[model samples]
Target chain A: MAHEVTVLTAGELRGLVQLDLAAVDVVERAFAALASGTVVMPPILSMAIPEANGEVDVKTAYIPGFDGFAIKVSPGFFDNPKLGLPSLNGLMILFSARTGLVEALLLDNGYLTDVRTAAAGAVAARHLAPAKVETATVIGTGIQARLQIEAAHLVRPFSRVLVWGRDMAKAEACAADIAERLKITAEAVADPARAVAQSQLVVTTTPAEHPVFKAEWLHPGLHITAMGSDQAGKNEIEPAALVAADLYVCDRVSQCEALGELRSAIAAGLWQGGTPPELGEIVTGRHPGRCSDDEITICDLTGTGAQDTAIATSTIAAARKAGAGSTILT
Target chain B: MAHEVTVLTAGELRGLVQLDLAAVDVVERAFAALASGTVVMPPILSMAIPEANGEVDVKTAYIPGFDGFAIKVSPGFFDNPKLGLPSLNGLMILFSARTGLVEALLLDNGYLTDVRTAAAGAVAARHLAPAKVETATVIGTGIQARLQIEAAHLVRPFSRVLVWGRDMAKAEACAADIAERLKITAEAVADPARAVAQSQLVVTTTPAEHPVFKAEWLHPGLHITAMGSDQAGKNEIEPAALVAADLYVCDRVSQCEALGELRSAIAAGLWQGGTPPELGEIVTGRHPGRCSDDEITICDLTGTGAQDTAIATSTIAAARKAGAGSTILT
Candidate 1:
């Protein structure tokens, strides 16, 4: 008989200690294992569902290298407001590889994904961003913007955080929350251009189809982590941004080409050279990272199966140690 | 705040009272959606990981029609002792196409998978098998064989069940268990040929490297559901059986080519004039099913993603209704 399964509710996940800085370490470790080919990573399979005058996208990726699957089910409704709920509600499954057991149940709907994605930002910063970066500018003041602020602080202690959302009040609230929680000075900027210009380390977390950040806003030695633009036809950075960068890195080269900032750059014939080094290759020391202090670097993270597996596995272990789950045998 | 998540353990799944044949209904619906081009089902992706001295295989499939993934993570350890554990262990994820929300988590490990596979058998029988079929024979006496029996009972009332295994005692014990639980008279047959020759409906559920049942054993007006031969070099029915059958159906053409008994038949040039209809195609009415009672139809159920999605969704819903999980807020 198997032990009782532990259920981690959305409320429970929210109440659990924010896995901010520590989660970065966990993601990094998982990537390192992935680079060494120690992790079991599965491919991403996606389907497009055409319903009555509408379509929904469903994608599933196996991260055996991490031992879990990150399934993204997104429904596009032109009338989401009429439904009184957000258009997107996603869930992830983290199953154990050892015994083929589902050790932990994560029911954040989408909160866990947002938080873990922010945690990835922190992980990328520790490895790619410059040390002791003082300022962080985040585009988009949605739920992810707040998380990016908290997660960015885990790697670099920012004295000021500038945010730019579609709405001024929303951005202001995001900055205010970060300021109150982390004791960092937070300011809402009127324009994305100004926000990116103000900070040496900029994070783009918007769902804008148009280019929100331009090359003119980027400076030498600045490290930009493009957090949004995860799907096709969604781009947050200008094409010039790719041409201006001295170094470019991506989570997965194939995926980034189809669904990240690379999509726009490639479409504009700006991505002339070979594919950027995989984050794993950089972590494994196969490719040099940040060759010069003055060279501008950009890390494109569209998210991958490896990250989902890592976070899910780590959370299960933590939940078990904390006596957080019940065991029931089958 | 999100609702408290319910955690359903394997024990809870085992203790489930209403297994809700609704999953069977869901699969049936999904198949109909499939043939009409209303459903999009992609081919499965498989990755082989070579260990220090052994190798492990990871198989993944996306069923757009069902909005779910059926992932199988099984050990390649063909050398391990059977210590009452099946070699396959993994959980299926069911994502709601309506909201892209994961509606349920079914942690049957492999038990749910076994039942679902059997349910597929039931699904196949509803469409392909002869109506009011009386005699049935099961090739192997493993746990999968038990499921096949139970699932078959759902479709046709078999007053007599013939069982055969490598070991005579195990086969007799299986017959005893079936007789006690299903209240049907199950008789153990000493030889595989006897079991196959006697029944109008036959299901082979063994992990044999070579064929166990010969073409000579099969009679006219028979329906053979080849449940085994899911992997390369694992076959239960002879290639001659393919030549003898008047109509043939498979789960997925690409998958069957690599792992099912279809591999051998295809290799031997036995798949001559007609292309075998997919089980989904038959379910969706794209292809004719069982035209005549004596048509000698055969449904090769290698299993597919639709089955997995249906079961996972149904299991999770059942778990939730029973209050089978605890709440953990993160």
Candidate 2:
């Protein structure tokens, strides 16, 4: 049988997909499907290349109603910056759900991952953040720091943004970029605790091996989205913060227990409540996300294959409609 | 930094690689690397799409000293034949071990998997099959049946082959194909027991849920390579047959126990010996493969990710040298 696969470059994907409300809705639907318990997502297959200081993770999910499923390959090489390259990049391959044939190769160079991840934060904020927000804080100086702030602004029209990082210069640069891009008041804060205390919503986006957000800073009406702890040995929130929060949610319960803030919380003996509700449950209205403005909420976003599948599926559809990629016959 | 990936179609891969001695050697080296204990191979990530009567598996391994590693995606839709589509088709993506950047996209549509799987059979026969073999039998009239006979011929130089299957007509067709392809005498036998008793080497390649090769047919100096059982609930050899053999080896012990013939053997309470030696162990000389020609041997080939990495690395290298694929820069 003749087979054809559409190949989209990162440049084309950037033109096709953005961190907009539509992207947020697509990811939100994925969470709802995940809540339906029909999404088949396996644990990630990861390999570490110690010699090169690199690691690669393969993730996939099969959503029942989707026309296609996506298998995403993400690689993180810490030392790549030394070679004047970004530390993280990879691609996703979409296959026909019925025929199991190749449909598209999404060479997004981690752009889709970035958008999906940030959109997940937006979903969390849309469901769990305070009704009124004047200030938002992002605890990192990475690409996600900017994206998370932009995503949060889409849900909650926060006027002021604070960027916090260990490196003050990078933080200042990031804050400047956000200010120029969003045309809002943005500042680089030296202290994360003060930033969290003042902001109504906080998003952590660092690859820190220790907590960057503290429990003492988590105040009433504040929602924290911790997204950097997607791998073992990485943490961005204090374990006690989960215990202090009125409602603690996860992207996926099992994944958070292994690779999210819940791991550290369990390890520190701070998490006594077993199996927290997932974001999907909240999205499906099975669990109330935030009952009151005074309640402190935290959402652990470890990212998921369902999000990748949803975003890839949507991106390919858009690409096909726009005729944005080259097709190769096999 | 600019990134480039080579995309090789199945036709290009077929032109670059073949079911030959070199392929066998590459697979043999992978076995050796696996036994060395440095190959980082994660458990396969699989999902069942019951709605489509299909299943997809993602397998990857990082073998040290290799420039690249392959992540192979294999999809099997059992009902595809009705739609005039092959049941199995997929692709592999090879990534740079150093930079974690994609090196190649192998659109082989399961062709490389076929060659590597057949080469593994040849590796088993080379190590376990007795010398001076005049007749060999294949216990299925599938693609692997012909490949197994041809692969074994590369090692044992078997003069005659017997093809056995449930359908006599299909068996005769496979036998005729093998006879014409290899220029050797081949026959289709209805009696599986008689075929086993007459042959010095036998390779079972059926996806039967129950045992297809009986223990009573075991004869001295016969080497049985069971390559069919790579998933749970699929067994080709009777459980008692494992106990009847003098020596039993595996491509991978844990995989075999879960997905290969050994799963049935253990369930039948017949496998008393704990943790049998692997094919890699035999390749590395850690275990004597065949003590004597009179000893009955069984090697369970459940396949491995290491072979995929090895074959993919070699294929890409050959493709690069031959300039056989299109390169896309991202």
Best model number under lDDT: 2
Q: How close is candidate 1 to the true structure, as a TM-score?
A: 0.81
Best candidate, DockQ: 2
Per-residue lDDT of candidate 1, residues A1-330 (tens digit): 454455666665666636577788777765666566555444455454444122344343334444444433334443444556555455555544434444555666666667678887887777777776888898888777888778888888889999888899998999999899889899998877776666778888887899888878878768898988777878988988887888888877777898899999999888886778867777778888887667788888887766666666677667767876545444
* CAPRI-style class, candidate 1: acceptable
Candidate 2 per-residue lDDT, tens place, B1-330, comes to 568899999888889999999999999999999999999988888889999999999888999999999999999999999999999999999999989998899999899999999999999999998987999999999888998888889998888999999999999999999999999999999898888888999999999999999899998999999999989979999999998899999998888999999999999898998889999999989998899999999999988999999999999989989989998887
Model 2: how far residue A23 lies from native, Å: 0.7
Per-model TM-score, in order, reads 0.81, 0.99
Off by over 4 Å in 2: none
Give the worst 10-residue stretch by lDDT in candidate 2 chain B: B1-10
Please write out the lDDT profile of model 2 over residues A126-244, one tens digit for every residue: 99998999999999999999999999899999999999999999999999999998999999998888888899999999989999888889799999999999898998899999999
Quantify all predictions' global Cα lDDT against the true fold.
Answer: 0.69, 0.93
Residue pairs that clash (backbone atoms under 3 angstroms), model 2: none
